[model samples]
Target: MNITVHRPGDLTSADRAAWTALQSKAHLNGSPDLANPFLSPEFALATGQWRRGVRIAVAYEGGEPAAFFPFQRSATGVGRAIGLGVSDCQGLVHGPGFAWDARQLLRACGLVVWEFDHLVGGQGPFETGASGSFPSPVMDIDQGYDAYLGHLRERSPKFTRTTLAKDRRLARDHGAVRYVHDERDPEVLAILMGWKSAQYRRTGRSDRFAHPWISQLVRRLFHTRSDSFAGILSVLYVADVPVAAHFGLRSERVLACWFPAYDPAFSRYSPGLVLHLRMAEA
Candidate 1:
């Protein structure tokens, strides 16, 4: 096998095709937490100008594409998995029989240390190279939505009952219960941003909303579609008023949950939790 490093924006069409093909075959190989659209050549190119230290490494075996690694390098001779904080899954996308050295790959990428958190299990190259684990909760939205809610009720009985009761009371007083599944509404994104920003301020945390790229990336991703991931925006309403919203990505088998927020005025309704339950149902 031969390895080659390509700048983030320099992946060719052939490389893109090969990378995506491997992604399809190894659906469960990487982290399951967050979807990295950065793995997409088009998305890489689209956000290249704003993404510092981005790089791609493509590996070939017998002159055939075998694996792809996306990473970012910092000035301190260290590299990190690209989209680290947001991507639930992190690691190289590779073919089944491919063999490569993770240390060599990082060295070739011009880094002394390569760090990753939330790495998907079975990343052979990084298996022995320093790693740890953490819990990431996932709802199986596959058995259709109802079955998923049933599981949630079993696992989180108190949370489920409380959220459901709040939702029922909200509907009774508000006069109607309405929900928009997979809503492609830009307005919903705006509301989520506002709530998220306020939450950050109230908690005395640095606001991600201050970064325009973060906001733009979320909006851009909401409209992006591919076999590996689908941009899904959903909103819940009470009496025609928007109360809760969530934005996320779903591959056929996994939903990468992201930003979620609800109108503070409806905090008594616990709309955000209810929206997730409804989403799990759908």
Candidate 2:
């Protein structure tokens, strides 16, 4: 096996194809953490805006691409997983039964310590170092919308009742309720950014919207579509205007939920929570 390091923004079309091929073979799941979007070439390119230390490690065996590691080198000779804070999964994307020396890769990338928080299970080289587990609640939406709602009712009776009542009240007082499940509307993305920014400010949190690159990345990702990490944007509408919206990634069966926000005008009605219920049904 041979390994080579490529500087940020140096990957060619062929390198991208090889990386994508390796990712496809890994059979990524929808947790947004393990899915390929954050690990995709496009994402790495965008992440260069925030993290200027990005690099790609491509390993080849018999002249065929076997594994691809997307990582960032810090000033302290440490390598952190790419998209460290924002990405749900942090690990190597590789072909079946692929194996490599983690220390060697780190050294090649000029790093001493490699750290990752959300490393996916079954990452051959780094699996042993994963220290803890993080719980991500998921609702299966495979059996059609009604069936999912039934599952929700059975699993979370109180939550279901309260949310349904809220929905009813929202419709009665505000206007008729309308939902645009899996809506690809750009307006919804804009609305979500506005609400998310407001939430950050009202709560005294750092505003992600204050960063131009982060904002640009979100907007760019909202429009990106590919097999590995296609953006799935869904919205809940009232009188033809989006009141609630969600942005996530759909990789196979898993739908990794990311940003979700609702119109503050409808906050009393809890439109955001209502939108989640509808999303689980979709």
Candidate 3:
């Protein structure tokens, strides 16, 4: 067994494929949603380009890449899960049976300590670092949109009906409804950024967009187009004007919902909910 560390941008083209395959095993061997966008080589690549100290440790067993651990390291030896706040799931992408000493692995990465929140279960080495865990709400569309909606219909009939009715009313009252998934127009994304900032201030929360780095990261990610990971900017339009929108990261099969906001002028119609529903279907 061996561990090879490299800056994200230094990764060879072949390393990306191996890392992606290892990530795939994480999904197929367990929950499909384990295939998080943040774990994709694309995320690491983007972050490496945007910031310094981004490192990835590729563990090879029997001369083959077996696992991947990506993190950002401080000069003082503190390490954090890559893309921490924006990443929904965090972990070393490994085969189901893979296990290693957490401290040893951290040391291999030249880290004295490692920290992570939202670390996925089934990770053996990092178990000792976990103080506690919390449940995060996630929509499981593994059964496809219709099947999941069927479950929603049975579970919350009124809620589902009301949301759908509002969707219809929104379309009728406005003009034709146009839900664009994977929208690439930078102007539309700028609008989403504005709406999100206003909402954060209105709700008395710290606006993340206020930070230049955070804003820059999103802008950099917006241009990322890869087979395993890409930015998904979805917009809900009424009468050809943008109403609600969400920007997220997705692999071919999994989507990590990130920035989601809507025009408050249309708040009465609950455009955010409507946009989410459309995103799920797409």
Give the number of the best model, judged by lDDT: 3
User: Each candidate: what lDDT?
Assistant: 0.74, 0.75, 0.85
Clashing pairs in 1: 31-89, 33-88, 34-88, 145-281
Candidate 3 lDDT:
0.85
Clashes of 2: 2
lDDT of 3 by residue, 1-282 (tens): 699899877777887898787666666687454578877788877767766689999998998888888899999999998877766778887766777888889989999998898898677679777999787678898889999999999999998999999999987888889999989899999999999999999999999889777788899889988777889899999988999999989887778888999999899889999899899898
Q: Report clashes for each candidate as comma-separated counts.
A: 4, 2, 0
Tell me which of candidates 1 and 3 scores higher on TM-score: 3
* Alpha carbon lDDT at 183, candidate 1: 82
Per-residue accuracy of model 2 over 1-282 as CA lDDT, tens digit each: 788888757877887887765555454432233444566666776676566788888888998777778888878888888877677766777766676788887787788988898777666577667677677566766678788888888988998899999999988887878887666778778878888899889889898888776777777777777666667888887877788888876554456777888878889988989988877766
For residue 152, what is the lDDT in candidate 3? 92
**Model 2 ranges off by over 4 Å:** 25-36, 127-131, 182-187
User: RMSD of each candidate?
Assistant: 2.8, 3.1, 1.5
Who is ahead in lDDT, 2 or 3? 3
Residue-by-residue lDDT tens digits, candidate 1, 200-257: 8888988887888777777777887877666788889887888888887665456667
Q: How far in Å is the alpha carbon of 280 misplaced in model 1?
A: 1.5
